[model samples]
Target: ARLLKQYQTHLKKQASYIVEGNAESKRALRQHNREQIKQHPEWFPAPLKASDRRWQALAENNHFLSSDHLHNITEVAIHRLEQQLGKPYVWGGTRPDKGFDCSGLVFYAYNKILEAKLPRTANEMYHYRRATIVANNDLRRGDLLFFHIHSR
Candidate 1:
C-alpha cells in the first residue's frame, strides 16, 4: 500500500512537470509567432489569432496530452495489460494469460493496475461512467467504446 502510494505520488509529480513543460512549450511557440507578427505586422491579415493557431498545432502532437494525469493513468493501465497479451480467453476469468470476457477483462485491468473497479457487463460498463460522447476524431487512448447491441 505504501509502495503503491509512493508510485502514484511520483507519477503525479512527473505528470505535473510534463504538463508544465507543455504549457511552456506552447508559450514559447506563441512568443515566437508574436515576434513574427511584430516583424511582419503589415504582411498578415488584421486581428490575428496566433494563440489559436499555436493551440491547434500543439494539439496535433499526440504526446501533448500524455502529460495529463488521467491520460498517464490510462497509458500505464494499457502498458500493464499489454504485458499479459497472450493470455487465454476464459468465460469470466480476470487473471492474466487465463482468458477474460470483455467486462471481466475491463474489471480486472482497471482494478489490478489503475486501482479502479468498474462494474461488469457491457451495458453496465457503458452507462456506469460519466463520460461525454466524443467524435471518432476526438477519441484518445483508453476512450470507452459504446454500441447499441440490440438497436438498428
Candidate 2:
C-alpha cells in the first residue's frame, strides 16, 4: 500500500511537470508562432489558427501561477537530489549508489526536483526544453539556463 501510494504520487508529479513544461513551451512558441509554422512543418502539430481560443484559455488557467504551487515542488525535488549527490559515479548511473556524469547529474537533478525527465545529455536537454531565450536579468530561481563552457 505504501509503495503504491508512492508510485501514484510520483506519477502525479511527472504528469504535473509535463503539463507545466508543455504550457511553458506553448507560451514561448507563441512569439514566433507565424514564422515558425512557415519555416518548420516538422516541428509542431498542424498549424493552429490565430482565432484559436483553447490555447488562450489554457494560458489563462496557468497564468496566476502562484509561487506556492511551484516552490514546494522544487524544494522536494532538490532535497531528493541533494541526498544522492555523493553517490559513486558509474558510466550511466542514475541512482545514488552509483556515480554520475555531467548529463546524468543534470538529468537526475531535474528528475528529482522537477519530476521532469530530461534527456541525459546537455545538448539534448537544451533541445528538449522550450526555447524561451531568457535574458540574464529575467532569470528566476528554477529557470534552467545553459552556458557554453569553452566550446564544451
Candidate 3:
C-alpha cells in the first residue's frame, strides 16, 4: 500500500513540475523496489553469476520491464499479501477489508490482475485448465504453483 500510495503521488506530481520535485517522489516510489531487492537477495542480479548465459539473457532481455516494473509478478503479489499479514484469517472471507482464508487470499490477489476466473475452492484449481502446467524446476515469477500439503 505504501508503494501504491507513493506511485500515485508521484504520477500526480510528475507532470506538474520538471525539477527535483518529481525526483524526490520518484525516490519514494523506488523505496519499495529497493526493499524488494533486500527481501530477495537470490534473485538480485550480481557480479559472480554474470557469466551464466541464461541469467545473462534474462537480464539483458527484460524487454517488457519498465523502471517501475522492477519486481517480478510474484513479488507484486507478495507485496499485496504482506499488507494483510496481521489480519485475522477468517474462513470464507474474500476481501482484505473483511479478512481471508487460503483461497480468498489467492482470489483477492489474482482475480483482477490476471483476469482469471478461479474457482472458490482450493482443490478445484487443479481441475481447471486455465492454469498452465509448470514443472517445479521450471517455475517462473508470478506463477500460482501449488503443492499438496495434507490429506483432507
Q: Clashes in each model (backbone N, CA, C under 3 Å)?
A: 4, 5, 0
Q: Residue 68 in model 3: shift from native, Å?
A: 10
Winner on lDDT (1 vs 3): 1
> How many angstroms is residue 43 displaced in model 3 relative to the true structure, after the best TM-score fit?
24
Model 2: per-residue lDDT, tens digit, 36-65? 444534233344456557545434343223
Better of 2 and 3 by lDDT: 3
Off by over 4 Å in 3: 1-73, 149-152
TM-scores of the candidates are: 0.52, 0.49, 0.48
C-alpha RMSD of each candidate structure in angstroms: 12.9, 9.3, 12.8
> Model 2: what TM-score?
0.49
Candidate 3 lDDT:
0.57
Give the range of the ten consecutive residues with the poorest summed lDDT in model 1.
58-67
Is candidate 1 or 3 superior in TM-score?
Answer: 1
What is the per-residue lDDT of model 1 for residues 29-128, given as tens digits with 9 covering 90 to 100?
5565566445534222344555776544533432323345455556666666676677777887876757877777777666555433456776777776
lDDT of 1 at 93: 81
Query: lDDT at 20 for candidate 2?
Result: 41
Best by lDDT: 1
Clashes of 3: 0
User: For residues 7-111, what per-residue lDDT tens digits would candidate 3 score against the true structure?
Assistant: 455445543443233645645534544454345443333423434454334333332233443343345567777878987789998888889998888777755
